[model samples]
Target: MATLDLTQENFESTVLENDFVIVDFWAPWCGPCRAFAPIYDQVSENHLDIIFAKVNTEAEQAIAGSFQIRSIPTLMVFREKVIIYSQPGSLPASALEDLIVKVRELDMAQVHKEIAEEQAGHA
Candidate 1:
Protein backbone atom coordinates (compact mmCIF):
# COMPACT_ATOMS: atom_id res chain seq x y z
CA MET A 1 0.00 0.00 0.00
CA ALA A 2 1.08 3.58 -0.60
CA THR A 3 2.17 5.72 2.33
CA LEU A 4 -0.39 7.97 3.99
CA ASP A 5 0.20 11.65 4.65
CA LEU A 6 -0.74 12.11 8.29
CA THR A 7 -2.26 15.20 9.79
CA GLN A 8 -3.54 16.01 13.26
CA GLU A 9 -7.04 15.16 12.13
CA ASN A 10 -6.32 11.58 11.15
CA PHE A 11 -3.15 10.70 13.06
CA GLU A 12 -4.80 9.48 16.26
CA SER A 13 -7.44 7.45 14.47
CA THR A 14 -4.95 5.89 12.09
CA VAL A 15 -2.68 4.72 14.87
CA LEU A 16 -5.53 3.55 17.07
CA GLU A 17 -7.43 1.66 14.38
CA ASN A 18 -4.49 -0.05 12.73
CA ASP A 19 -2.92 -3.16 14.18
CA PHE A 20 0.57 -2.02 13.17
CA VAL A 21 1.71 1.39 12.12
CA ILE A 22 5.04 2.83 11.08
CA VAL A 23 5.30 6.59 11.18
CA ASP A 24 8.07 8.59 9.59
CA PHE A 25 8.39 12.04 11.12
CA TRP A 26 10.12 14.24 8.59
CA ALA A 27 10.56 17.72 7.19
CA PRO A 28 11.04 18.75 3.60
CA TRP A 29 14.22 20.75 4.08
CA CYS A 30 16.16 18.01 5.85
CA GLY A 31 18.55 16.25 3.55
CA PRO A 32 18.35 12.96 5.39
CA CYS A 33 14.58 13.04 5.45
CA ARG A 34 14.57 13.59 1.69
CA ALA A 35 17.01 10.75 1.24
CA PHE A 36 14.96 8.37 3.36
CA ALA A 37 11.63 9.03 1.69
CA PRO A 38 12.11 6.66 -1.22
CA ILE A 39 13.51 3.96 1.04
CA TYR A 40 10.49 4.25 3.31
CA ASP A 41 8.19 4.20 0.33
CA GLN A 42 9.83 1.08 -1.05
CA VAL A 43 9.53 -0.70 2.28
CA SER A 44 5.91 0.36 2.58
CA GLU A 45 5.09 -1.28 -0.72
CA ASN A 46 6.41 -4.60 0.53
CA HIS A 47 4.38 -4.49 3.75
CA LEU A 48 0.75 -4.39 2.78
CA ASP A 49 -0.52 -5.29 6.22
CA ILE A 50 1.19 -2.42 7.98
CA ILE A 51 0.19 1.21 7.82
CA PHE A 52 3.05 3.42 6.59
CA ALA A 53 2.38 7.04 7.40
CA LYS A 54 4.36 10.24 7.20
CA VAL A 55 4.00 13.29 9.40
CA ASN A 56 5.58 16.45 8.08
CA THR A 57 7.15 18.01 11.11
CA GLU A 58 7.23 21.36 9.42
CA ALA A 59 3.52 21.35 8.88
CA GLU A 60 2.55 19.45 12.00
CA GLN A 61 4.57 21.15 14.70
CA ALA A 62 2.11 20.28 17.48
CA ILE A 63 2.27 16.57 16.76
CA ALA A 64 6.04 16.69 16.41
CA GLY A 65 6.41 18.57 19.68
CA SER A 66 4.12 16.12 21.46
CA PHE A 67 6.45 13.32 20.45
CA GLN A 68 9.52 15.42 21.39
CA ILE A 69 10.99 14.88 17.96
CA ARG A 70 14.29 16.69 17.96
CA SER A 71 15.48 15.41 14.62
CA ILE A 72 14.17 14.78 11.18
CA PRO A 73 13.63 11.25 9.85
CA THR A 74 12.48 9.97 13.20
CA LEU A 75 10.86 6.57 12.86
CA MET A 76 8.19 5.30 15.24
CA VAL A 77 6.42 1.95 15.22
CA PHE A 78 3.12 1.41 16.96
CA ARG A 79 1.72 -2.05 17.62
CA GLU A 80 -1.76 -2.55 19.03
CA LYS A 81 -1.92 1.15 19.93
CA VAL A 82 1.29 1.03 21.93
CA ILE A 83 4.51 2.58 20.79
CA ILE A 84 7.05 -0.20 20.43
CA TYR A 85 9.91 1.56 18.67
CA SER A 86 11.03 5.12 18.23
CA GLN A 87 14.36 6.46 17.06
CA PRO A 88 16.07 9.21 15.18
CA GLY A 89 18.07 8.91 11.91
CA SER A 90 17.56 7.48 8.51
CA LEU A 91 17.71 3.72 8.23
CA PRO A 92 18.73 1.81 5.15
CA ALA A 93 16.14 -0.38 3.48
CA SER A 94 17.56 -3.55 4.98
CA ALA A 95 17.46 -2.21 8.51
CA LEU A 96 13.93 -0.97 8.07
CA GLU A 97 12.90 -4.36 6.74
CA ASP A 98 14.61 -6.04 9.67
CA LEU A 99 12.77 -3.76 12.07
CA ILE A 100 9.48 -4.72 10.48
CA VAL A 101 10.33 -8.38 10.95
CA LYS A 102 11.16 -7.82 14.58
CA VAL A 103 7.99 -5.87 15.18
CA ARG A 104 5.93 -8.59 13.53
CA GLU A 105 7.56 -11.25 15.66
CA LEU A 106 6.74 -9.48 18.89
CA ASP A 107 4.31 -11.20 21.26
CA MET A 108 1.82 -8.43 21.91
CA ALA A 109 0.13 -10.22 24.79
CA GLN A 110 3.41 -10.21 26.65
CA VAL A 111 3.97 -6.62 25.76
CA HIS A 112 0.57 -5.61 27.06
CA LYS A 113 1.12 -7.56 30.24
CA GLU A 114 4.38 -5.75 30.79
CA ILE A 115 2.74 -2.41 30.19
CA ALA A 116 -0.03 -3.20 32.65
CA GLU A 117 2.45 -4.32 35.25
CA GLU A 118 4.48 -1.19 34.79
CA GLN A 119 1.40 0.95 35.12
CA ALA A 120 0.36 -0.91 38.23
CA GLY A 121 3.79 -0.46 39.75
CA HIS A 122 3.60 3.26 39.10
CA ALA A 123 0.19 3.39 40.69
Candidate 2:
Protein backbone atom coordinates (compact mmCIF):
# COMPACT_ATOMS: atom_id res chain seq x y z
CA MET A 1 0.00 0.00 0.00
CA ALA A 2 1.15 3.51 -0.68
CA THR A 3 1.55 5.88 2.24
CA LEU A 4 -1.54 7.97 2.81
CA ASP A 5 -1.37 11.60 3.82
CA LEU A 6 -3.03 12.16 7.19
CA THR A 7 -4.62 15.40 8.28
CA GLN A 8 -6.46 16.63 11.36
CA GLU A 9 -9.80 15.75 9.85
CA ASN A 10 -9.05 12.13 9.02
CA PHE A 11 -6.51 11.13 11.63
CA GLU A 12 -8.97 10.00 14.27
CA SER A 13 -11.21 8.14 11.87
CA THR A 14 -8.27 6.38 10.26
CA VAL A 15 -6.93 5.17 13.57
CA LEU A 16 -10.34 4.05 14.78
CA GLU A 17 -11.15 2.15 11.62
CA ASN A 18 -7.82 0.52 10.88
CA ASP A 19 -6.66 -2.54 12.80
CA PHE A 20 -2.99 -1.82 12.25
CA VAL A 21 -1.51 1.56 11.38
CA ILE A 22 1.90 3.14 11.16
CA VAL A 23 2.06 6.95 11.25
CA ASP A 24 5.07 8.97 10.33
CA PHE A 25 5.08 12.55 11.63
CA TRP A 26 7.34 14.72 9.55
CA ALA A 27 8.14 18.24 8.41
CA PRO A 28 9.32 19.30 4.98
CA TRP A 29 12.32 21.18 6.24
CA CYS A 30 13.67 18.30 8.30
CA GLY A 31 16.58 16.64 6.62
CA PRO A 32 16.04 13.34 8.40
CA CYS A 33 12.38 13.29 7.40
CA ARG A 34 13.31 13.74 3.74
CA ALA A 35 15.86 10.94 4.01
CA PHE A 36 13.32 8.64 5.64
CA ALA A 37 10.51 9.27 3.14
CA PRO A 38 11.66 6.81 0.49
CA ILE A 39 12.45 4.18 3.08
CA TYR A 40 8.98 4.53 4.54
CA ASP A 41 7.42 4.34 1.09
CA GLN A 42 9.39 1.22 0.22
CA VAL A 43 8.27 -0.58 3.33
CA SER A 44 4.66 0.46 2.82
CA GLU A 45 4.59 -1.21 -0.58
CA ASN A 46 5.47 -4.55 1.01
CA HIS A 47 2.87 -4.31 3.79
CA LEU A 48 -0.46 -4.31 2.07
CA ASP A 49 -2.31 -5.22 5.25
CA ILE A 50 -1.10 -2.24 7.24
CA ILE A 51 -2.27 1.32 6.83
CA PHE A 52 0.87 3.35 6.37
CA ALA A 53 0.23 7.04 6.79
CA LYS A 54 2.15 10.27 7.10
CA VAL A 55 1.31 13.56 8.79
CA ASN A 56 3.09 16.58 7.45
CA THR A 57 3.74 18.43 10.69
CA GLU A 58 3.97 21.75 8.96
CA ALA A 59 0.52 21.33 7.51
CA GLU A 60 -1.09 19.37 10.31
CA GLN A 61 -0.10 21.20 13.43
CA ALA A 62 -3.14 20.16 15.40
CA ILE A 63 -2.57 16.49 14.69
CA ALA A 64 1.08 16.79 15.60
CA GLY A 65 0.28 18.66 18.78
CA SER A 66 -2.30 16.10 19.86
CA PHE A 67 0.31 13.38 19.57
CA GLN A 68 2.93 15.54 21.32
CA ILE A 69 5.27 15.04 18.43
CA ARG A 70 8.48 16.65 19.64
CA SER A 71 10.58 15.71 16.67
CA ILE A 72 10.24 15.15 13.00
CA PRO A 73 10.43 11.61 11.57
CA THR A 74 8.68 10.20 14.61
CA LEU A 75 7.19 6.79 13.94
CA MET A 76 4.12 5.60 15.79
CA VAL A 77 2.46 2.22 15.49
CA PHE A 78 -1.13 1.60 16.44
CA ARG A 79 -2.85 -1.77 16.75
CA GLU A 80 -6.47 -2.47 17.67
CA LYS A 81 -6.91 1.27 18.21
CA VAL A 82 -4.19 1.36 20.80
CA ILE A 83 -0.83 2.97 20.35
CA ILE A 84 1.65 0.11 20.60
CA TYR A 85 4.89 1.89 19.83
CA SER A 86 6.08 5.49 19.44
CA GLN A 87 9.59 6.64 18.85
CA PRO A 88 11.57 9.49 17.42
CA GLY A 89 14.19 8.90 14.73
CA SER A 90 14.56 7.53 11.27
CA LEU A 91 15.14 3.80 11.01
CA PRO A 92 16.94 1.76 8.42
CA ALA A 93 14.84 -0.45 6.15
CA SER A 94 15.91 -3.62 7.97
CA ALA A 95 14.99 -2.20 11.34
CA LEU A 96 11.65 -0.95 10.07
CA GLU A 97 10.89 -4.38 8.58
CA ASP A 98 11.77 -6.05 11.87
CA LEU A 99 9.47 -3.65 13.71
CA ILE A 100 6.58 -4.54 11.43
CA VAL A 101 7.16 -8.24 12.14
CA LYS A 102 7.16 -7.61 15.89
CA VAL A 103 3.99 -5.54 15.72
CA ARG A 104 2.23 -8.25 13.72
CA GLU A 105 3.30 -10.92 16.18
CA LEU A 106 1.94 -9.05 19.21
CA ASP A 107 -0.83 -10.74 21.18
CA MET A 108 -3.41 -7.97 21.23
CA ALA A 109 -5.60 -9.71 23.77
CA GLN A 110 -2.78 -9.57 26.26
CA VAL A 111 -2.01 -6.01 25.34
CA HIS A 112 -5.60 -4.96 25.88
CA LYS A 113 -5.70 -6.76 29.21
CA GLU A 114 -2.57 -4.91 30.32
CA ILE A 115 -4.10 -1.61 29.25
CA ALA A 116 -7.27 -2.32 31.15
CA GLU A 117 -5.32 -3.22 34.25
CA GLU A 118 -3.23 -0.10 33.99
CA GLN A 119 -6.30 2.09 33.57
CA ALA A 120 -7.96 0.42 36.50
CA GLY A 121 -4.93 1.04 38.65
CA HIS A 122 -4.92 4.66 37.61
CA ALA A 123 -8.57 5.04 38.41
Candidate 3:
Protein backbone atom coordinates (compact mmCIF):
# COMPACT_ATOMS: atom_id res chain seq x y z
CA MET A 1 0.00 0.00 0.00
CA ALA A 2 1.06 3.58 -0.63
CA THR A 3 2.12 5.68 2.31
CA LEU A 4 -0.56 7.95 3.72
CA ASP A 5 -0.25 11.68 3.22
CA LEU A 6 -0.79 13.49 6.49
CA THR A 7 -1.80 17.10 6.72
CA GLN A 8 -2.58 19.50 9.50
CA GLU A 9 -6.24 18.68 8.88
CA ASN A 10 -6.07 14.88 9.23
CA PHE A 11 -2.87 14.50 11.22
CA GLU A 12 -4.51 14.13 14.60
CA SER A 13 -7.16 11.65 13.52
CA THR A 14 -4.77 9.45 11.56
CA VAL A 15 -1.91 9.29 14.04
CA LEU A 16 -4.07 9.06 17.12
CA GLU A 17 -6.31 6.37 15.69
CA ASN A 18 -3.56 3.98 14.73
CA ASP A 19 -1.86 1.74 17.28
CA PHE A 20 1.47 1.89 15.49
CA VAL A 21 2.45 4.75 13.27
CA ILE A 22 5.69 5.90 11.67
CA VAL A 23 5.62 9.48 10.49
CA ASP A 24 8.25 11.16 8.39
CA PHE A 25 8.49 14.95 8.47
CA TRP A 26 10.01 16.07 5.20
CA ALA A 27 10.05 18.77 2.54
CA PRO A 28 10.08 18.40 -1.20
CA TRP A 29 13.14 20.59 -1.66
CA CYS A 30 15.27 18.83 0.91
CA GLY A 31 17.98 16.65 -0.64
CA PRO A 32 18.10 14.16 2.18
CA CYS A 33 14.33 13.94 2.27
CA ARG A 34 14.30 13.27 -1.45
CA ALA A 35 16.84 10.51 -0.97
CA PHE A 36 14.92 8.94 1.89
CA ALA A 37 11.55 8.89 0.14
CA PRO A 38 11.98 5.60 -1.66
CA ILE A 39 13.38 3.86 1.39
CA TYR A 40 10.43 4.95 3.52
CA ASP A 41 8.04 3.92 0.79
CA GLN A 42 9.58 0.48 0.61
CA VAL A 43 9.24 0.09 4.35
CA SER A 44 5.62 1.15 4.18
CA GLU A 45 4.95 -1.38 1.49
CA ASN A 46 6.76 -4.15 3.31
CA HIS A 47 5.17 -3.45 6.66
CA LEU A 48 1.45 -3.41 6.01
CA ASP A 49 0.63 -3.90 9.65
CA ILE A 50 1.95 -0.44 10.55
CA ILE A 51 0.77 2.94 9.36
CA PHE A 52 3.28 5.13 7.51
CA ALA A 53 2.41 8.76 7.10
CA LYS A 54 4.22 11.76 5.64
CA VAL A 55 4.08 15.32 6.87
CA ASN A 56 5.25 17.92 4.40
CA THR A 57 7.10 20.52 6.42
CA GLU A 58 6.47 23.30 3.96
CA ALA A 59 2.80 22.61 3.46
CA GLU A 60 1.87 21.74 7.01
CA GLN A 61 4.04 24.22 8.84
CA ALA A 62 1.94 24.23 11.99
CA ILE A 63 2.04 20.46 12.47
CA ALA A 64 5.73 20.27 11.62
CA GLY A 65 6.54 23.20 13.89
CA SER A 66 4.67 21.59 16.79
CA PHE A 67 6.89 18.52 16.41
CA GLN A 68 10.02 20.79 16.49
CA ILE A 69 11.46 19.22 13.40
CA ARG A 70 14.73 21.07 12.92
CA SER A 71 15.89 18.80 10.14
CA ILE A 72 14.31 17.22 7.12
CA PRO A 73 13.64 13.50 7.04
CA THR A 74 12.96 13.35 10.75
CA LEU A 75 11.16 10.15 11.68
CA MET A 76 8.86 9.71 14.66
CA VAL A 77 7.51 6.37 15.78
CA PHE A 78 4.32 6.28 17.80
CA ARG A 79 2.79 3.31 19.56
CA GLU A 80 -0.62 3.47 21.21
CA LYS A 81 -0.66 7.24 20.67
CA VAL A 82 2.55 7.87 22.61
CA ILE A 83 5.79 8.78 20.94
CA ILE A 84 8.41 6.05 21.34
CA TYR A 85 11.20 7.09 18.99
CA SER A 86 11.98 10.50 17.54
CA GLN A 87 15.10 10.35 15.37
CA PRO A 88 16.37 13.22 13.27
CA GLY A 89 18.20 11.52 10.45
CA SER A 90 17.67 9.45 7.37
CA LEU A 91 18.01 5.77 8.18
CA PRO A 92 18.73 3.06 5.67
CA ALA A 93 16.15 0.30 5.10
CA SER A 94 17.85 -2.20 7.40
CA ALA A 95 18.24 0.33 10.20
CA LEU A 96 14.60 1.35 9.82
CA GLU A 97 13.50 -2.26 10.10
CA ASP A 98 15.64 -2.72 13.20
CA LEU A 99 14.12 0.36 14.75
CA ILE A 100 10.61 -0.97 14.06
CA VAL A 101 11.52 -4.26 15.69
CA LYS A 102 12.90 -2.53 18.78
CA VAL A 103 9.86 -0.32 19.09
CA ARG A 104 7.56 -3.32 18.83
CA GLU A 105 9.40 -4.84 21.79
CA LEU A 106 9.23 -1.69 23.97
CA ASP A 107 7.42 -1.78 27.28
CA MET A 108 5.22 1.22 26.56
CA ALA A 109 3.48 1.55 29.90
CA GLN A 110 6.76 1.56 31.78
CA VAL A 111 8.32 3.91 29.30
CA HIS A 112 5.45 6.36 29.54
CA LYS A 113 5.46 6.23 33.30
CA GLU A 114 9.18 6.93 33.38
CA ILE A 115 8.73 9.88 31.06
CA ALA A 116 5.98 11.24 33.29
CA GLU A 117 8.15 10.94 36.37
CA GLU A 118 11.00 12.70 34.61
CA GLN A 119 8.66 15.51 33.56
CA ALA A 120 7.28 15.90 37.07
CA GLY A 121 10.77 16.03 38.57
CA HIS A 122 11.74 18.83 36.17
CA ALA A 123 8.71 20.88 37.15
Candidate 4:
Protein backbone atom coordinates (compact mmCIF):
# COMPACT_ATOMS: atom_id res chain seq x y z
CA MET A 1 0.00 0.00 0.00
CA ALA A 2 2.38 2.66 1.30
CA THR A 3 5.74 2.95 2.98
CA LEU A 4 5.74 2.42 6.75
CA ASP A 5 7.81 4.55 9.07
CA LEU A 6 9.73 2.07 11.22
CA THR A 7 10.95 3.19 14.62
CA GLN A 8 12.76 1.38 17.43
CA GLU A 9 9.40 0.76 19.05
CA ASN A 10 7.96 -1.22 16.13
CA PHE A 11 11.02 -2.42 14.24
CA GLU A 12 11.30 -5.81 15.94
CA SER A 13 7.70 -6.89 15.52
CA THR A 14 7.20 -5.40 12.10
CA VAL A 15 10.45 -6.43 10.45
CA LEU A 16 10.80 -9.82 12.14
CA GLU A 17 7.38 -11.22 11.38
CA ASN A 18 8.75 -13.96 9.12
CA ASP A 19 8.11 -11.93 5.98
CA PHE A 20 10.03 -10.12 3.28
CA VAL A 21 10.89 -6.47 3.88
CA ILE A 22 12.70 -3.69 2.09
CA VAL A 23 13.86 -1.06 4.52
CA ASP A 24 15.09 2.30 3.39
CA PHE A 25 17.42 3.78 5.97
CA TRP A 26 17.37 7.51 5.51
CA ALA A 27 17.52 10.90 7.17
CA PRO A 28 15.36 13.90 6.46
CA TRP A 29 18.34 16.19 6.00
CA CYS A 30 20.08 14.07 3.36
CA GLY A 31 19.73 15.26 -0.22
CA PRO A 32 19.94 11.79 -1.76
CA CYS A 33 17.43 10.48 0.74
CA ARG A 34 14.91 13.11 -0.31
CA ALA A 35 15.49 12.30 -3.96
CA PHE A 36 14.85 8.60 -3.38
CA ALA A 37 11.65 9.04 -1.35
CA PRO A 38 9.32 9.25 -4.31
CA ILE A 39 11.01 6.34 -6.08
CA TYR A 40 10.69 4.23 -2.95
CA ASP A 41 7.04 5.21 -2.72
CA GLN A 42 6.56 4.18 -6.29
CA VAL A 43 7.97 0.76 -5.49
CA SER A 44 5.46 0.35 -2.67
CA GLU A 45 2.59 1.41 -4.88
CA ASN A 46 3.47 -1.24 -7.44
CA HIS A 47 4.40 -4.11 -5.12
CA LEU A 48 1.43 -4.63 -2.87
CA ASP A 49 2.71 -7.80 -1.17
CA ILE A 50 6.11 -6.50 -0.17
CA ILE A 51 6.54 -4.63 3.10
CA PHE A 52 8.22 -1.31 2.39
CA ALA A 53 9.58 0.38 5.49
CA LYS A 54 11.43 3.59 6.15
CA VAL A 55 13.69 4.27 9.09
CA ASN A 56 14.89 7.76 9.85
CA THR A 57 18.52 7.35 10.85
CA GLU A 58 18.43 10.55 12.83
CA ALA A 59 15.61 9.21 14.95
CA GLU A 60 16.50 5.52 14.91
CA GLN A 61 20.19 5.89 15.54
CA ALA A 62 20.48 2.63 17.42
CA ILE A 63 18.78 0.67 14.69
CA ALA A 64 20.87 2.35 12.01
CA GLY A 65 24.04 1.64 13.92
CA SER A 66 23.05 -1.97 14.38
CA PHE A 67 22.74 -2.31 10.60
CA GLN A 68 25.99 -0.46 9.99
CA ILE A 69 24.33 2.04 7.70
CA ARG A 70 27.15 4.29 6.56
CA SER A 71 25.17 5.97 3.81
CA ILE A 72 22.16 8.24 3.88
CA PRO A 73 19.91 6.33 1.48
CA THR A 74 20.72 2.70 2.07
CA LEU A 75 18.31 0.01 0.97
CA MET A 76 18.33 -3.28 2.85
CA VAL A 77 16.29 -6.24 1.73
CA PHE A 78 15.25 -8.73 4.37
CA ARG A 79 13.53 -12.09 4.37
CA GLU A 80 12.25 -13.70 7.54
CA LYS A 81 14.01 -10.94 9.49
CA VAL A 82 17.37 -11.77 7.92
CA ILE A 83 19.08 -9.29 5.65
CA ILE A 84 19.67 -10.47 2.08
CA TYR A 85 20.73 -7.40 0.19
CA SER A 86 22.13 -4.05 1.27
CA GLN A 87 23.34 -1.17 -0.86
CA PRO A 88 24.05 2.49 -0.48
CA GLY A 89 22.73 5.51 -2.43
CA SER A 90 19.49 5.93 -4.35
CA LEU A 91 17.94 3.84 -7.08
CA PRO A 92 15.81 4.63 -10.09
CA ALA A 93 12.11 3.78 -10.21
CA SER A 94 12.50 0.92 -12.68
CA ALA A 95 15.43 -0.53 -10.78
CA LEU A 96 13.40 -0.39 -7.58
CA GLU A 97 10.57 -2.30 -9.22
CA ASP A 98 13.00 -4.92 -10.49
CA LEU A 99 14.35 -5.39 -6.98
CA ILE A 100 10.86 -6.04 -5.65
CA VAL A 101 10.27 -8.62 -8.33
CA LYS A 102 13.57 -10.32 -7.61
CA VAL A 103 12.85 -10.48 -3.91
CA ARG A 104 9.45 -12.00 -4.49
CA GLU A 105 10.96 -14.76 -6.57
CA LEU A 106 13.59 -15.84 -4.06
CA ASP A 107 13.29 -18.98 -1.96
CA MET A 108 13.41 -17.09 1.27
CA ALA A 109 12.13 -19.78 3.60
CA GLN A 110 15.00 -22.13 2.85
CA VAL A 111 17.46 -19.29 2.99
CA HIS A 112 16.27 -18.11 6.38
CA LYS A 113 16.29 -21.61 7.79
CA GLU A 114 19.81 -22.17 6.56
CA ILE A 115 20.92 -18.90 8.03
CA ALA A 116 19.29 -19.74 11.35
CA GLU A 117 20.99 -23.11 11.48
CA GLU A 118 24.32 -21.59 10.66
CA GLN A 119 23.92 -19.01 13.40
CA ALA A 120 22.84 -21.70 15.86
CA GLY A 121 25.92 -23.75 15.06
CA HIS A 122 28.14 -20.73 15.66
CA ALA A 123 26.33 -19.91 18.87
Q: TM-score: which candidate is best?
A: 1
**Ordering by TM-score:** 1, 2, 3, 4
Greater-lDDT candidate between 1 and 2: 1
lDDT of 1 by residue, 31-109 (tens): 9999999999999999999999999999999999999999889999999999999999999999999999999999999
TM-score for all models, in order of appearance: 0.99, 0.98, 0.91, 0.89
Q: What's the CA error at residue 19 for candidate 2, in Å? A: 0.5
Cα distance off (Å), candidate 3, residue 31: 1.2
Best by lDDT: 1
Which residue pairs show collisions in model 1?
none
Clashes of each: 0, 0, 0, 0
lDDT of 2 by residue, 23-87 (tens): 99999999999999999999999999999999999999999998999988999999999999999
lDDT of model number 1 = 0.97
Give per-residue CA lDDT, model 4, range 10-113, as digits (tens). Answer: 99898778487899999989999999998899768877777899999999999999999998799999877778889998999988888877877888778878
lDDT of 3 by residue, 81-105 (tens): 8888898989999999999999999
Cα lDDT, all candidates: 0.97, 0.96, 0.92, 0.88
Model 2 worst lDDT window (10 residues): 1-10
lDDT of 3 at 80: 86
